[model samples]
Target chain A: MFNFEITALGNMFFGLTVLVFVSLFFVPNKHRSVTLYSLLFASLACIFYASDLITLFIGWEIMGWSSYFLIAKTADKQTLQKYIVFNIGGAFTLLGAIILIYGACGSFVYSELDFSAVPSGQVTAITILLLLTLFVKSGIMPFHYWVVDSYSQSNDLFSAVLSAIISKTGVFAFILIFFQIITVQYLQTPILEVVAWLGVLTSIIATFKAINEDEAKRLLAYSSIAQVGYIVTILSIMGSLSLEAALYHTVIHTFVKLLLFINVAAIIYVSKQHRFSTLGGLLYKYPLNFILLVVGIISLAGMPPLGGFSSKFLIYTALLEEHKGLLLAAVLFSSASAFLYCYKLVYGIYLGQPTNPKTEAYPRIPLRFYVPQILGAVILITLGTIPGVIVPMFNGILGSVGFEPVLYRGVFVLGSDFASFNGGVVIGAFGLIFVLILLFFVRLKNRSVKPKDRLDISYCGEVPRADVNLHYGYGMGRELSRIGLIKMILSRSSHALWQRVSTLFGDLSGITQKLYTLSAQNMGLVIFAFFTILLYMGVK
Target chain B: MQKGFVAYNNEQKSLEAETEGIKNSQTLIQKAMNWFSARSMFVVAYGTGCGAIEMPPVFTSRYDIERLGVVGVATPRQADIMIVSGYCSLKTLRRVIRTYEQMSEPKYVIALGSCTINGGMYWDSYNTIKKLEEYIGVDMYVAGCMPRPEALIEGFVKLQESIRNNTIQPGYVKYREDYAYYQANQEKLLGKETQPVYEEDYAGMNLS
Candidate 1:
């Protein structure tokens, strides 16, 4: 039925190849495995172009299992088990929902499935199931336990792949469900609204955890959760442009995470340290890696002239369109939280004084590692400079999904009918201003300013100790954890309160366990009492 | 019945009953004295182990032996109170020393639920302490773990009922002599030689 079947099959093979390769990374003969992983990754790029759901699912499941095995290969048995269980749970839910849809419409074909025929209840159920599956994969809150366990435990290289390639499966699933299957016009439930709120909550909670987490890998894992939360929120907007925003965001986040994780991995591999508390003053030691990390972190922080800003700006526009004032406020709050963690990630690792005095030479990264990171940075910068090229392809996808694709006029006007950003004007002004500043700085440069043995960072009278490590720990989020009404609304302390309620259950279960141990007849009596209560309620 | 109710017989019966009551009263007084002597006071040390390190400083010779009339008692039956200092680790948590039973009337409890107040440094630590009061009831947490010796003394001074009504008959041998149970648990959690290097008397030694 489709000429793209070869592409689909090739992609599926590549996905499997990547999975197999990544799984075997710990083996002594790892070069062949890396080759296989790259081959699979290349094939997956083809799979992304699949014409139908069947082919898509093949690629999808292959990607899922391959990543799962890869993650499993990296983690301990307990974490791997949780990773498998959580992923399988999501996959099965997705499979069941697909089956239900096929049963309702009597087709496996994505192009053939009619949206109008799906009964409201069935549609709602399918949406919920799909959303749940996707949320689990994305590592959204409450469902995020597997993410940290898997990401933090994985080999550093594999951690890069997991953060980049694997979690994007959630975004793919979201596109399929939110765009292809469900019509945005079917006005019924507050499901999307709930998702938006969930995103905000997820960001807040994950950021707090990220702030507290001592392990570098775990911190990155929490950060990934926070980013995915933003993506999910944008997708839930269900606007044509928001789809573009989501896709752009996915691309940006993937590259940024890949870059950051690789840089961190390089740092760890060189220093044999994984905790931020132990890592400091590396800017002087590993200048190139440090620069790469800064680029990645700044992009992650959504600073202007980077990839994060453009996509985030689109999401904000969508929110403004919907007049979601509170959500807009939350978006800003989460962004500020991003700044807090970003500062810690940079200042804690490189800017602060070295705690350990026994200095070691910095290890050079294999060209293989730096290439991918450099490619990612280049893509990020190019995307910021010229958003024109990919905007059309995303428009096509969103248009097919039944949302009006925004047509850009050189990254300024939308659809030739409306106006937005004026890239020419802004870029020209920015370039002129930059040149002037550079000229002034060059002219004002002072040769007399010599390098000091020690730099003063703090205002206190005590001279900056070369050995004392300055760490901004979990206490940074203390301001947000207010004891008042806001905390009552957003905090999960209620889950802890439920522990008290469960204590009652614990008491009851304990008594019951003891009673059953003492006599089976006592259990029979209990069952009889339960039936008696049921009978009484039935009569009433 | 009418014959038994004669007036002279009734008067004789009343006199005999009064004499029997007086004898019963004397026996009751003797029993009360014996019960008083037999009563052993039960105090929940609520020591929470690491903070229990500072207890010797207050009880030993350098701090003066008995100004407050309170001595560290081992068994709950021989103790009248509990002092919770900072941090409770999960492994050493069993010996927190809270008991609802065997305590005499007018018992008091203080909460140390903040790492026993709000899980201070131990909040994020999984294997460390949690809400201490949620398990064994505490009476007047001494606030800080390794609280200043002054604060520990202050807590003791505040607990006067425990001082004045010293009904607890502590076995001085057990209270003042042995430290096996505490040592074993400590050794189990942290192997032998893990007791901090600095002794209480070492003023010049640098401790991190």
Candidate 2:
């Protein structure tokens, strides 16, 4: 009998147990919870590394249940209940896939199971089922409705952990499916191509939704889906380079998202403003924090020299290498469209005028605030600069997955024929040169000119009124919507779909809940009607 | 297996060393080494409510917020702008007040979404506050239930307008005045007074 490794399973169990306890604390003081959650995540990573199917299944269930509870801590009772139901459904599907594999091969161990021995149809079914389960967890399109409600509703700290670690269980599942179950012949079908297309579609739709979103946390939730779409598109390429790029993106994304979420929490914690309409002109007040947040946002946006660009570049190269023209164009368009949202984030909060005159005083940011994000930002920049350091480790991972090794050629330059500097060297040199220029500028400036608060000039003869309420809203996406042709495709709103679904489910559940309260005779009559209907159908 | 462990351990140490080289450190040697590293500014990670939807692009690859000096800060003390995106519930208001209290002074508040201003669709809802002025003051309001990212961008520009104008300043005196008016009004209007759960009164409590 194939048995789960007790050690690995226990690790997952420990993580889940810890998460349950961690959910009890409040924000800004959830350092204890963060510590425990980190431990739990570590345990999970180990279980995934262990890699026996039974062990994997155990770890999977543990991670799902743990994260479900994490979502529960901040979500309303209804949303939490829905989150649990959706998660359980995904978990059960995963269990079924494992059972099917065992039934076919008479083994649950991942290494010994031979996918080639199984029929192509069965393999396809298993792959699809597994993908469904993972997609549900990863917040892929059509299956992603629960994420925003769950994440946005949850406590800020809980949201950070959920976004960072829990959602990634799907990526781990994808890894297993790509390497262990599906072969190249199977992946070459139009089905994989369809999956890639779906990712592109999801990204486009989710980005627009994010652009128009008002709730800060909800916007992040939608952004999470968009980022996941990028990963899905790359992973569906089924090439070694693409897979590696996907991994890179996943790693970078996890940390960047964590930083972003925590930063959101810090803002909410300090400012007492959860809506952007009421917040502005904080950059001057909290210069240190503004700078740190900029680091996180830049890294997230895939700016050149930050961690985001590295992964995006890799994914683009992989797509180009495969000569997937349409996908490349979609990526390009998506990349260009990203600017609108990024500028919104920057200009919306810090760069604008202060409408609320009372918020001029800067509140204290806790020491813990800087520690985690600083560490994350550092890691992102480091990875972006010197990817070669991690190349060997990825190579080992590729070996384990039975993929060929690949190298990262640095950015290139055109010469008489062809000449290129390594990306690391070229980027590193420019970065150095830029830093030198900035330093020179800083040094050249007169120290005697003590910087004072800069204000807007009152133009003309008119005295500027303080209460005109300066803010930019409603017009953020007008240009992009009109210009990008996204208006046609992204017109389908998730909120509308979910609203309809919630209404339907609300009615169905209402009826079901009242079913048992009926008299015994009534219940019997209902059962009789059901049976009669089934019999009539069978007979027909 | 032991050899594999050793090799992995060695690799890990080297990675840490290289990482430390690029990271911000106080030591002179470390600073000298980091001169070549790319400089990035901080951004306050403030999400009000629905308006927060626009933040992803700024932080993500499309807009690349790093070219500018903005980054996401994780705490109130470090943050510069507090971006409130949309509407606020009574439940959320309590936390928001506490968070605002925690942030270091010289902070900014950017309110995103129309709900934060006049409560939008939730204006009549008992749970939501119609006038944000009644509670914590706001700096900039990006008007929309969910404002577009471009609107948020424009809001940021407007916020910059205020900041450069030197019009933005702490208004604790106004809050104090409003609080006093609120207290007196509550006593007169409601007869029995119920203090705000989030804020503290300057005068001593009525023990009797």
* Highest DockQ against the true fold, candidate: 2
Quality class of the docking in candidate 2, CAPRI style: incorrect
Write one digit per residue (lDDT tens) for candidate 1, span B1-208.
Answer: 2221111211335534544554345455444543442232233555555665666676778674256555655544444555555677754553443132223223444433245655776778877656554444344455664455655665554444322333222222121122354345445554663232212222342321
Q: What digit string (tens of lDDT, one per residue) describes model 2 on residues A85-124? A: 7778887888888888888788777667787678877877
In angstroms, give how far residue B2 of model 1 lies from its true place.
99
Q: Relative to the unseen true structure, what is the Cα RMSD of model 2?
A: 21.7
Candidate 1 docks at the CAPRI level of: incorrect
Please give, for residues A1-540, the per-residue lDDT of candidate 1 as tens digits.
322433322343234335433433432222234543554464355346566655555655666666666666657986776677677888788788878888788876666777686678887887888888888889887777678878998778777777876777777767765666556765244988999889878887787667656677888898999988988988888777677777778878888887788777777777777776777777787777778888888788886666666677777776777788898788777877788677777766676665556435656655555765776687676666567755776666665566677757366332223225644444567788999998888886222222234333321212334555454442444555584643544355333553466589879999878755746787788899999999999999
Runs in model 2 deviating more than 4 A are A1-27, A30-43, A408-421, A432-455, A458-462, A473-475, A481-484, A488-491, A498-540, B1-208
- Best model per lDDT: 2
DockQ of each: 0.01, 0.01
